[model samples]
Target: MSPRSILFFLTLFVLGITASAQYTEKINSNRPGTSQGAFSVGNNVLQLEGGMGFGKEKHKIFDTKTNVFNFDYTVRYGLLIEQLEIRLNGRFRADGVKQTVGANEEKINRSNFEINTLGAKYLIYDPYKKPKKDTTNYEALKSWKEHYKFRWKTLIPAVSAYVGANFVTSDNPFTFPDDPAFSPIFAVIAQNNWSTDYGGDWAFVTNIIVDKVTTDNPAIGWILTATHTVNDKWAGFIEYQGQKSDFYSDDILRLGGAYLFDQDLQFDANIAFNFKDTPSIFTFSFGASYRFDWHTKDEIIEKPGLEGGVKEGEEQENEEQEGEEGIDGEFDEIEGVENDSLKLEKTPFINTFEDDSFREELEQDLDERRTEERLERERIEQEKIDKKEGKKFKKEEARRLKREAKEAREAEKAAIKAEKEKQKMIEDIDAELDKMEKEQGVDGELDDIDKQLQELERMENELNQEEKEEQKAEEKKAEEKKEIQEEDVDAEYEKYQLQQERAKKEEAKRRKKEEKRRLKEEKKRKKEEEKRKSQEKKEDNENLDIDKELEIIDN
Candidate 1:
């Protein structure tokens, strides 16, 4: 690849290391230093940052001494998005130059805008935009090392791109004689932020810039900065800036600190120096940053579910309603059948062939027979439905029990594994302490090691306590599940008992009807035997009268 292509790709790589733009509750300012931050001020926020400084420069080649007074300012306004901002940056410089030309000294004065640029920066990549998942339930089970492990994702920084134009008028003292009226400037910015073990936050920002691209003496430079946030209101930073060009080449270092006065304001101070003896430079500066925030709260929109365009909550409610309606309908159908049978049993079945009192007795008997038959059919059908439902309930209960058992086993195994790991770590630490003692004897390092061992022991004790709490929670859950199972069994047993009582009542009614029918049959049999004996006696008397009539006729 050509040098230009390679440079373009390299710029992109460096830009990938920058910080993402995000709206913070407190004003975020790049101050006390000249390096640019990757993030914008925030959408709809206008910020002003400026500084004033004095410096002295001496050039060995020309035997010239110069006194410089400079003021630099940046007016930044977040545009249509949080990730984009437009800024106006300018530096005004006044210089008094004294030169010795062969012992004939001369003094000259020059003043102009050393740098003025209008640019817009847009964030291209943001690694921190995604939220981290919550793992509170399992956090206590994790080892100390695992809990504090470094995340590789943090290595990927947020990146931003900057494009601007430098407007230099004719005969500017700060620019090369061959510089054009308008020159393009392009930059790639990157930043990485992470927390230290000591609870402090660190931010590293990088900027790769190509300035005055249209001019004969184009400059390429880079700025690297490291900032540490000591507390809520105090922060400190160190920066290194390097520039290379046909016109000038120099390296500068700066140290600075900032104090947050309020949510919208900050104060900062910094000192800068260069190592080059040709024109060794030193400067001190103080600055303040303030913002006018006009951002509003973002609106929240909920998307519909994939199936049937229903919302999740509404879909769940509809499912529950349908299930309830199904169960209710089943019960209603059974109750209706039962109510009809009951009314049939209660009403008298009239027997027109019998007397009024006998008809009433007969109706009662018939009604009992019909009621028994209807109830038997109903019981059979009900038992079938109950059996199916019971099977389903049993299957679900078994699956639930199996799942709970599996989870319990896994938890037990995890606890055992954690215990073993803790023991091994303790052993290793002890061995290290013993080896150190043999090698160096007891000293401050040994005491520090001992303190670490104590801290480890304390951590182990906390882990054990957490394990006990987890065990208690599991036991409580199991007890509640058992109670629910017992309640279900009690309900089933009560239903069975009710069914048995109904069967017994029906059987007793059937036996009473059989006894009444037997007595009616016995009374009818006795009446028939008496009638047969009376007819036999009347036939014997008629035969004797016929014999007497025949003897009188013969005489």
Candidate 2:
């Protein structure tokens, strides 16, 4: 093929490859709802997307070469089975063409519109398995799955065909067909991923299109494209499009990038060099798309709660606070003492009963007090050990209760599952029994089996109902336990607040006593200073008197 012819096919190939991949009949296509089979499979999804672009279009010299502006859109929906998929594809397009006549003739313009073509595809084989674990890491698992797939096109693999009429305005200069032209197109497309989870990675795709124009004795034309993604978003491709006759051909090579924002939206842009020979044509084209889905699915996990400890702690704090407050109230009931002696004695006095000893004796008593405190501390430590053991016992009881409840729940679920399996088995057995009866004459053996199956099914159903009732009882018990826990937490929080209040009061009392002691010491130190100054003055006076007396005696 001539370079121009090669460019032409390349351009057509680019169009096919860039078109929406949805496999459903576009409502706008002239042939509406025709190919209504499965076009895509694997996920039940629906998508709507469209694109508009401007590019140089060249026809035969005498026939006229034109710049073509076009807009197209498609909507698709598909069913995705575990290993199979079916899809419905649809598309529509409108084209504006400017053509030039021979010898620098003025250009002629025309418009054509087409819509509503349908198609479908089925995955003959897909190499993937259902996830076996609840926490299957899809990212890691994806690498383990096959990267290739085989599919069957209900009609033809990777082909989009639509029929529509082209109407030339009455004022147009070029000769045109009086009747609307029928345009039928067929294409084959292939796509594969290049080892990346992110779709921006490399991809290889190609397309082949065979088309028949409505006019000119049903002349045939074809286009081919080969595109390779150098990376996730950048791609390079070459295209050739031409009719069988030497009259029409164009070759083009394009380097472009497709920005896939997500599975729902995509944008593509390309710069093309057209080898038309007469006047080298440069073209830029851009496109965008949006996809939609019908049904969406997701998974959620259940959670477990903690045993009740915070509630107990809070209750303990509250009791301590209450006790502190009671102590404060009792201390406040005591008469306030104002004597300087009272201030001196503000620190808690060791009870000085009639038999209390002197200072050295007090010191010895203090040592004994310290020894007693040590012994008391040791006893309290032992008591705490015993209390901790008691708490452990209570904790064990709580754990046992929880375990029993859990076991009850598990048994209920097991019974339900067993019942379901039994029911299924009974159904299968009945089906087999019917088949055997149909094949053999009605016999006592078949009747006996049927009776047995029915009895077993009834028993299973009764057991399932009983298990369900027990499950309900357990659920009610759990709910009550939860409520009790909530109440305990509330009570504990209240207790903690009370304890904090009582601690604050006790701290205030301690601070007040310290302040009084500080004031008493200040008063005592001031008194002593005044006394020392007075004594010094007296001694000076006495010395002056003695000096005067000695002087008199000498005279």
lDDT of each: 0.68, 0.43
lDDT by residue (1-555, candidate 2, tens digit) is 565565555555445433422221111111111121212322455555555656664455445455656565555554443212223333232334444444456744555443334434443321111112223232432332321232222112222222223333343223233423334545443433222223222222344444445445343444344444454333444444444433344444565655655545656666666555544556666666555544332111111010111222543553474467642342243224211111111112323232323532543444344344435545655766788999999999999999999999999997787667656655755665565456443244445545665675576577657757865775565566666766688755654565576568657855765675565556556655655665565556556555644554453
Model 1 segments more than 4 A misplaced: 1-25, 132-141, 196-199, 298-555
Alpha-carbon RMSD, candidate 1: 52.7
Off by over 4 Å in 2: 1-43, 57-67, 79-107, 114-118, 121-184, 196-200, 213-248, 277-281, 295-555
Best by TM-score: 1
Name the lDDT of candidate 1: 0.68
TM-scores of all predicted structures: 0.50, 0.33
Task: Compare the candidates by lDDT and give the number of the best one.
Answer: 1
TM-score of 1: 0.50
Task: Give residue 406's error in model 2 in angstroms.
Answer: 77
lDDT of each residue in 1-555, candidate 1, tens digit only? 234434544553443343322123378788887777887877789999998998889998888999989999999998877778999999999999999988699999999999999999998886654322222223322344543455567677779999999998788988898888888999999877665334456777889999988788889998777777777888888777778888988878788899999989999999988777789898888989999988642211111110012223643553474477642343333332211011121221222344545644554455444444445445654766798899999999999999999999999997787667656655755665565456443244445555665675576567657757865775565566566756688755655565576568557755754674565456445545544544554455445444544543443
